[model samples]
Target: MTSPEEALQQARATYEEHARTCRQCHFDAVPCPVSKHLLRAYNNARREQMRANSGVR
Candidate 1:
């Protein structure tokens, strides 16, 4: 089972990768709000999955 911290870090890296591409696509324009939201959502999902798998109720 993956630790929550590891999962979260992985999620953050994914977000950062998207952010980089988004920034480039937009020419460093307005911040990528969607990417930020996605980051949080993914992290939350990972946490929930971890809890479910760990039988942590």
Candidate 2:
């Protein structure tokens, strides 16, 4: 079991890495808003899950 803080840190790092590449990827460019939304939701969910789990433990 990873500590909540550690898990959050890892999640943030991964999201940051994706953000760097997302802006430049042709697949992620202007025509697609879907990927951006998906990524946002994913990050939010991960953070929420971490918070919930952290609180419980």
Candidate 1, residues 1-57: lDDT per residue as tens digits? 766667777777877777778854357655567876867867796877688778897
Please provide TM-scores, in order, for all candidate models, with all chains considered together.
0.48, 0.44
| C-alpha lDDT of residue 37 in model 1 | 83
State the local distance difference test value for candidate 2.
0.61
**Residue pairs in clash, model 1:** none
lDDT scores in order: 0.73, 0.61
Most accurate candidate by TM-score: 1
As a whole number from 0 to 100, the lDDT of residue 6 in candidate 2 is 65
Please give the TM-score that candidate 2 achieves against the real structure: 0.44
